[model samples]
Target: MTARSGWVKIVGLGPGADSLVTLEAQAVLAEATDVVGYIPYVARVADRPGLTKHASDNRVEIARSQHALSMAAEGKRVAVVSSGDPGVFAMASAVFEALEAGPDAWKDLHIEVIPGITASLAAAARAGAPLGHDFCTINLSDNLKPWSLIEKRLRLAVEADFAMAFYNPRSKSRPEGFARVLDLLRETCEPDRLMIFARAVSAPDETLSVVPLSDATPEMADMRTMVIVGSSLTRRIAGTSHVYTPRFVAE
Candidate 1:
């Protein structure tokens, strides 16, 4: 399966599990002459003939995107792999950013972005649909934004009483920022608000924990975790701790 030369495919590999990857992404990988992505994601691709893998460290998205574009310019079929949906905190935007900011020649390259199963959706599926109702997705990493702005959004979300899915809850250098989020939730939400800590969803090392905001701790989450906070209408079933927000509100 040979992809046509001189194109770039920004593709998602899903959260984990080869079966979770979309057939379209798989087709592109089969035809790719070069694959570029973060180390873990590139590793997901099977080793095969005629496929050159280029893995890089995290936080170098722009550099990685530019490298893929350069390869495409040289008439290489390049696929940039991203875990989960490429458009959701992944490589799609980075590739486009590089194309827009790079030399004018890049605009002529054929670029396609393929989506995949994102972490939040996977986590919610595992946790019995805590996000079944109105919700918002927030990337808690302040790497690209200010902490003050994040805090403002946090308060506003709580004020609106919307269920929330948070990505990149805790990074090595920014562990304290998540702690601050917990504090804000404590101050703004009820003590019994349900919070779900879902880590590495669909992977072998996956873990899911549901607890009240009173018992929820920062240590439960890490960079790979997605935190889902239930809204005011969220509740635990009578016989168990399974939490969910109702699809319809009662008067």
Candidate 2:
């Protein structure tokens, strides 16, 4: 494709920190003629001459993806922004889904994914490596998937002894689901299993707390929080808030 031809770059803004934004994502933003994403994510991009920002509400991923693709097809350099890594529960998949179902010529457009740090990794770093060992990441929200699947995965992850990171743990519409998750963990794991609630990680108002599974409450987590449930081996330092899981599991 020629330089004047349209292209789409799915960009990750990282977890609430400008410094965490990857150089490649930044370069794409600088060159992009249009930015598209959720309201907050699109707002994260600084305004510049000749750049237009399109923001949409939640649950509109497909529509948003289609809009970006349409603009790209019209020869606009579009950047679709996501808060964390674009591939991790974000816009990259949505954009591809749109492209697949759209006109076949859309597939010929230049598209690239620019990666960035995800909430799980950022939260793990702030909490001293709780994800050091084998772990699985799951989105607790039932918006797109059934709650049964979420519960099933949680049970299996517990049985397999893998540390788990949960995204979209709780929200206003589904406040009760996280409590159910807590109960499920209580049934399947030890009371003292460490649970880390890393809220608004890397931002000015960031708060990180490590508590035992018995003491964890759903209220500690909100839409902005990243909840990490430790494996049996996960532990906190004797007198500090730091938590970690040993890299090697004993035979």
Candidate 3:
């Protein structure tokens, strides 16, 4: 497809608040004829004028991707919106899956993925630089994957001594997941390993705190929270709310 022709743009809307969107993402949205995403995610960009909105439930990935592709195939610029960096367990994957299945009509449609700030980055910034060194991110949700598999990754991360960031840490019905993660980490990391909890980062009710590993109880976190567990190299500076890990190795 020519640059002037209609194309599918999978844009990451970032985590919470409109201001968090990148300028390039905003330009894509402003030019698109259609926007598709989860209900809450679509709502974040609802006020944009002259755009057709298609909102779906959190579970309907295939349907959403097909709809966006169909629109793009019909010569309309379409943007598939995903919250918190589309590449990080967001809508971008589904978009490619739908395309890979060869929807037939969308074969020649040009697709572009515009990156945005993920929740982990937003949370890390709010709590200080816990991600300064090599780190790993894992989602604690067991809806799609087995808890055993999640536990295995946690163990690997801990043993590798990489600072860790956890997404979907806790929810109403799954309160034990985060605690279980902590228990697993305790086997490899000290109880005093630095931990940072950031809730609703960049939103109106944003909250951030830095504490030790043993102190990060389930009550201190929720689904909106992103937990950053530091490695042995992480430390706190005087009179600052951030915790940082050294990126350079000592000679």
lDDT of 3 by residue, 1-251 (tens): 44338788999998897888999999999998889999988888756677888889987997899888887887889999998899998888898899989657677888999999999999888777889999999989897799999999988888888998988899888989888887887777888899888898888999988888877777888988888889888999878665899888676
Which whole-number lDDT from 0 to 100 does residue 181 have in model 1? 96
- What lDDT does model 3 reach? 0.87
Which parts of model 3 have CA positions greater than 4 angstroms off?
Answer: 1-4, 46-49
Steric clash pairs (candidate 1): none
The models' CA-based lDDT, in order, is: 0.91, 0.94, 0.87
lDDT of 1 by residue, 156-184 (tens): 99998899999999988987989999999
Ranking by TM-score: 2, 1, 3
Question: Per-residue lDDT tens digits of candidate 2, residues 131-246?
Answer: 99999999999988999999999999999999999999999999999999999999999899999999999899999888899999989999999999999999988888789999
Mark the regions of model 1 whose C-alpha exceeds 4 Å error after superposition: 1-4
Which is superior by lDDT, 1 or 3?
Answer: 1
Local error of candidate 3 at 156, Å? 1.1
TM, every model: 0.96, 0.97, 0.92
